[model samples]
Target: MADRPTGDTSLPPRAAEFLELRPLLFAIAYRVLGRVTEAEDVVQDTWLHYQDVTERPRSPKAYLSTVVTRLSINVLSSARVRREEYIGEWFPEPLLEDPYQEPERAAELADSVSTAALVLMERLSPLERAAFVLREVFGFDYAAIADTLGRSQSACRQLVVRARRHMARGRARFAADRRAQQELAARFFAAIADGDVDQLRDLLAADVQLVTDTGGNAPAPPRPIVGVENTVRVLASVLPELGRVGLRLEPQPINGEPGALARDREGNLVQAITLETGEGRIRTIRSVSNPDKLTHLGPVADPWQLARDYRESRRRQR
Candidate 1:
């Protein structure tokens, strides 16, 4: 039985245990589902299921893990269709802060939660995603993973292997230097705010991809703008428009990567930009502008309406 919080002694022993491991359970579900709301629902559902258990488990963490994974997989089964029908490019909802922290596996933890890694994992089946996350990202043994999924150890290993093949690009990643990432991000956003197309070009890799997901709620390209020149051109064009609309950009860390948060005049978050870097330059610029995704950050504004307002303002000026 885990101890209750100081001064809150009425909390049940098992309930206290669940409270302590809530972050880990949420992390497991988030990695499996890639959506904050769904992952959180799974955690709550796990607690409800745990309350009904009559006997104590040998390991509370294992029990909680199994429950959360199962709930997350159930959600994932139905999520595939919704994702396919999503209005625009569907990226994982940006997370401003991760509750779970594995200091011993910090590098692996960071890489696994990256936007690129989550997008690539979308190719894997639901069970494969669960098994691979438990075994590879969290370093669970084969036996425990199998028990969690109610599959044979060999079957679990096969799922992980296949998942690895699908997500090979995410393998063996090391955490980037935080200071370096922040410094680079500072310069990059400064260039955007200044409308320095040439500086933006130099900061971008030769084959960078600028991807934005507005989910059709806001005006944006439906697909990624690939290559340095195209990305630079698009970025440069948007600068004046965003400035006209009074959408301010500020440097911030998003999903373990250097990124920025954009807000409209009302201080409503309009965009969460995450930058992936390699070779000392930006490789991918993922911006999640879908207001639904930005809810986690804070109040979200109507970017499409903002777009119209700014365009109308330009017309009046003309």
Candidate 2:
């Protein structure tokens, strides 16, 4: 057992073990789900389920891994229903920043979070994705993967092979160099923020797409913006208004690529921006502004307080 933090909610032994392995579990869940929000939820659920178990395992890391993997598989199986009902295009929720412990190690991690890789993973069946992420990304052998997947080793191996073939066909291989990508992303945001349509156009791919998720709680364009020219125009038009609302953009990593976080006047996060790139140009811009999604990105304004404020503002307007 490890020493406990003062008033910590977790049992000392459990907390120490969980802290040691949480990052690895997060990595697995993120790859499997391709959505940071969903991945975190699965990890939390795994911890809860582990606490309920009466019997103790010899290796807590292995036991926790099994829990997260199984929970991810279950979530993926049921996710199709929700995906179908989602408004606009549904892209994976992006990460706020690179969580790698060392700057030198950013590249390898970035490759795993590339938009192309994530989109390709979405093409696979849940089982295939799980098998590939476990075996390829995390380096789990067929036997270990099979244990988590509840399949024979041979079956797991076949699943991974199929997933790899699918990815090879669909994804263009790109080298991961975080510094170069970040520099490009910085220029891209600056152009858009300045409403330089021509510059924005030059930075965007010919077939760029933009998707916004506002969750019907706020007014937003209801459809995806497609084509480079259209995307530029849309972004250029909106950039000014965002600033007017006390929102400023801060560069951050999203889904392993350079992204932007929108902060309020006091520097509270209100939105997250993720851009997908291909052939040295931006291919997609995804902005998540829905409060439900923003919570994971940063501390959000309290809902009850926001409602009260809105009511008071309405009264003042009258």
Q: In candidate 1, what are the lDDT values of residues 154-208, reduced to their tens digit?
A: 9999999999888986542534676777788899999998898888988998888
For model 2, how big is the CA root-mean-square deviation? 5.2
How many clashes in each candidate? 0, 0
Q: Any runs in candidate 1 off by more than 4 Å, and if so which?
A: 1-10, 169-177
Could you say which candidate leads in lDDT? 1
Query: For candidate 2, which ten residues in a row score worst on lDDT?
Result: 1-10
lDDT, candidates in the order shown: 0.85, 0.74
Runs in model 2 deviating more than 4 A are: 1-14, 35-37, 52-56, 98-105, 173-176, 215-218, 266-268, 299-318
Q: For candidate 2, what is the lDDT? A: 0.74
lDDT of 2 at 72: 92
lDDT of 2 by residue, 177-236 (tens): 556677779889888678777888888888788877766544457788889778877777
